[model samples]
Target: MNAKKEPSIWQGFKAFLMRGNVVDLAVAVVIGAAFTNIVNSVVKGLINPLVGAIGTQNLDHYSSCLSSSCKGDQGIHLMWGSVLGATLSFVITAAVVYFLMVLPMAKYLARVEARRKAREGTHEIIEVTELEVLKEIRDALIAQRGSVHDER
Candidate 1:
């Protein structure tokens, strides 16, 4: 029993590992991590400067102090502005991708897929009731019987 159970457990593990989604997700995670560096560089190099020029100009770079000394333990300073800048850049990038790239691609692909499906002449399934199935079978049997009787 234990031997049988171990093989089944191993089979389950193999099946899980072989799933397309699991592999796809692992690749996506790795690629996304690599892509993050590119995103950050674009934010820092180009977007940050442009935004700065238009607005407060590198306001996020500095933090204020309640007192002069930022010595060892006590200071009332916050880098909330940099956090705000990073947040804004992220939001803007997301918006641009959603509006400019993802939205249009999704609509275009959907229409193309619809057209392809139409050309292929595949249709949606309509569920038939049990009565409908019985009626169809009855009609077929009657037609067969009529043919057989006519021959005799």
Candidate 2:
């Protein structure tokens, strides 16, 4: 009798970590973390200052008081400014990633696919033409053999 050995836990874990998607995901996470700093800096340095021209430079300070006697940590303070700041950061990040990276990559892939299809189409046309020529040659040979037999 023959038996197959099961994979050890260490081998299984190694295999999982060595997968292409796992490595790609890890890289994406690291890059995303680095990209986040850039986005945050842009928002704080540029966006906040521009918005500050209208009101406060810091969006976190902008808020509305709900309670009647509202003081420092006394009443209901709705920190809408922070929310707006976060929303802006997210928007900016998404726009940068989409325009700078995703959009260009998509366009490049599309062009490559189009070129590949064109090449395949040309090959198919050539193959069909060759087949047709072969069929004509076969018919001519057959006709010649019949004529030769008749002459005999």
C-alpha lDDT (0 to 100) for residue 150 of candidate 2: 100
Clashes of 1: 0
lDDT of every model, 2 decimals: 0.76, 0.97
Return the top candidate by TM-score.
Answer: 2
Superposition TM-score, candidate 1 onto the true structure: 0.54
Candidate 2 residue spans exceeding 4 A from truth: none
Model 2 clash pairs are none
| Residue pairs of candidate 1 with colliding backbone atoms | none
Q: In candidate 1, what are the lDDT values of residues 1-152, reduced to their tens digit?
A: 36544467888999999999999899968976776677777777877787778665564755667778876457877776698777866786677668977899999999999899886664332234556788999999999999999999
Distance from true position, residue 55, model 1, in Å? 8.0
Candidate 1: list runs displaced more than 4 Å. 1-7, 54-60, 64-74, 96-101, 116-152
What TM-score, computed on C-alpha atoms, does each candidate reach?
Answer: 0.54, 0.90
Candidate 2 least-lDDT 10 residues: 1-10
